[model samples]
Target chain A: MSASDDIWILGISMTKFGKHADRDVVDLGAEAITAALADAGITMNDVGVFAAGNLMGSAGIAQQLQKQIGQTGIPAYNVSNACATGATALRTAIMAVKAGETDIGLACGVEKLAGAGLLGAGGQEKSVGHEWTPSGRYGAVGPIDGRIGTEAMPGVFAQIGMEYLHDHQYGGTAFELFARISEKNHSHSTLNPLAAYSKAMPLEQIMNDIMIAYPNTRPMCSANCDGASAAVVVSGEKLRTLSLEQQRRAVKVSASILTSDPFEQACQVLPNINTLTRNAAEQAYEQAGVGPDDLDLVELHDCFATAELVHYDNLMLCEEGGAVDFFESGAPWRDGRMPVNVSGGLQSKGHPVSATGIANIWEVCQHVRGEGGPRQIEGAKVGLAHVIGLGSACGVHILEKSGLAA
Target chain B: MSTATTIPFVDYLVLEPEPHLIAHECTGCGARYFDRRNACAGCFATEFRDVDVASDGIVRSFTIVTFAAPGVEVPFVAALVDCDGTSVRGNIVNCPPDPEHVTLGMAVRLTTVAVGADDNGVQAVNYGFEPR
Candidate 1:
């Protein structure tokens, strides 16, 4: 790998992942950014640019954050791509560094979902009792049940589960296995004091809980969390100038892939999930010269736990119908072949929308640097962080061990 | 709520023979998107043209709600109808607007129907899916 191929995460930080009604968006964003700067052992003066990620904050959130954080004169900007907003900010930072625009940059994302409290897009026309009253609607199509109207996120994904069952009879046991996966993540979250919900739930409890959607339950859905995460990315040559101690622990970003939704590929029944994720993952592997099997860990988009099962095959870690079998194999466990999530994931750790993607990246950087504490995979040299926004847009990034990026 | 005619009251009301719903399609990506778009979300193609979505499809799934929390609904079926391969989660008309009739995977069609005369004495047609 050339010197130009080198890029390392200088530092990463995140606020507690939970509903902090007392705090506002700017406070969270500033806290995460300042914490990241301190962790990187650098001052704000070292950062040449700023990329903030936010969704549904009160208008002009980017400008407001800059003023709040006192990063006034800097190139403060915001990037929005739904759930992938955070990671997209990180990508912009990486591009800036790669294009010789800056030596150090920051990608920080914050969300205040609990504050919004149901920003219902389901506005109804007033009824003076003239015509029939319709239910909450989606698009030109009026209100319908199960598809979108008030259905649980996992419940909506269950339609795919039904289709999956029809396509391949992946059974009840597969869900039980996913519960085990969640259990492992919860155990990790318990060690992570900043995590929203850290209680380790039993597999049986998840399997038998009242269904939110068929074959889906409340536990399978990622909670609508409120929090923030920040990361500092720097050129590889910059790391080389650091002390031996810092050099030993520096993590390198190998590849970053950002993409929009495919041609009318609806979230429900996304035909060729394998091809979509695999295509993106393949580009990352090729750019990084690393394969999926070589990855020490991954933080996939488990917005719905079932999607995690589906992605096992989509990421080409297993065959088409092999997710159930692979899950049953227990190879994706913390102590198993390749520990995934280990950070509780969205399932247990929580999903703060715009902040999830970068949070995943920040966790990977820590894991690769042997700083993941209890959730750390033993001898992790390569890690991947994945996020698929609204089951539409997606991104996958590969991070290498210190001094191993090409 | 009954707009039923008594003695052949077809003097002022005239129903179109070929009832159709106006919609837009992205010429760039050959995908049928109901809402209008300046660029194709699929392929980023800038070309598009107006199209009439066949008011027909199978009712994929549905639910009927009776407003009890001080709401104004006599009763209506919230139908998810798949129109000509494009599954649209919309409402169904023609029936008594009951959930039982709005069965899952039932054949349906999309068409413009004039419910009644509006305040201006002109026809007010809305797009809805109904059993074929």
Candidate 2:
């Protein structure tokens, strides 16, 4: 990529992540966009393109949101890849800027899940499409028979956890390790004012919480919340046009990669062991010219406690089946080396599906800018953000402090 | 009283005297999938043929779901059963949904059971694996 192709994150903003029953999806989205524009010190007219992502909203959400925030009639796109919706939207914006199609672009993600039923209905009036229904729903339109037709999301992860335990020979220690992860995330949340749950939760409380699925309690699962996050990115030429102060605060987008799961023998039997995440992370590291060991901080998807543990290996932060030992070594702690999820992650910050990926980006950008107050990692330079959706897809991004400004 | 007619819980199930799940195998790469595919993921081969999966297999993994869709009973055993070379996901019927009974690698045989009823009052028969 040429210097002209480089994309710089000019501004990032996120709404407080928690239940907002009164707010609708558009309201959440508009607020984030307005804030991002204000933070970038650029007006809506300066934004040449707009990209939006959400799982539940109808089509043309980007235009709808832009209409609410002064429609410049710039080209707008709506991107969706399940939980990776936010990052996908960001990737779209990066593509637009890097392609020289636009000088300034905005990527935003908003989801209103509070008070919605277990599925977090995004207020979509009609079903848009159908895929393999997990066991819970009645009408599963696939060929596999004699398969459990009613297992919900929690159950699916529980099975994964069970397989991990059985394969790693962890026995009872696996559950303990999971609780420790929850505890660590909860502790991290205490320092994150934007998190949904800022109060630290004890390991015992997490372990003893009502079991939604075997090996997973209430705290072990990411909560459904209503939130939105947005980022503004501009091309390197546009960065030169910015004020000196803004340039100093800007973060460079080193790499962004998105991938999907390949068809394998079975849904559970991932071809290369969570290949989607691994491939995305590997591509991101190569593009950024940095490996897992070089990452100063990371905000990975933790929809389930077990997912965080599995992703440790998937992201190559540790060797396969070494997540337990990694957790015990305090390597992922807020003050420890390679601190992760210091923005409280999805577990404590709440996962509003479409907003999750951008929320991860917001956290990473904060650390890279040295703006993370209480949870700030000292002298953090390189940061990574990762998110996955089970349909399924994964997105990974690497951000570094701009050397030109620093 | 209306007599309940038995129907395959899922459309792909062939509910005969000896029940077995249907799978589509790619002729080019010998890869199998429960759903129809336009192209084989392994070899990108388009040709496929229908085959019946084995009735018995070992439990690769299992979980007791405490919450599920409405009208679906909770606390049921959902498992991934390896039937011969293929892995099948289904509920473990005729066995308790506890770790003591639903251990990994436990042998299980396939059987048909009532999952629920359709709108027309026909009983939906679904297949599941049970301890052999």
Q: i-RMS, every candidate?
A: 8.9, 6.8
- Candidate 1's displacement at residue B90, Å, is 6.0
Over the stretch B1-132, how does candidate 2's per-residue lDDT look in tens digits? 446466665655777766788788899987887766788888899999988888889887777767655545667787878899888778898987777788877899998876445455556677888899
Worst 10 residues of 2 chain B by lDDT: B115-124
Candidate maximizing TM-score: 2
Instruction: List lDDT for all candidates, in order.
Output: 0.66, 0.80
List model 1 lDDT by residue over A315-384, tens digit each. Answer: 7677777777777787777777877777888877888888888889888887788888876788888999
Maximum-lDDT candidate = 2
Clashing pairs in 1: B55-B109, B55-B110, B56-B109, B56-B110, B57-B108
Error of 2 at A11 (Å): 0.4
Where is the poorest 10-residue window by lDDT in model 1 chain A?
A138-147
DockQ of each: 0.11, 0.41
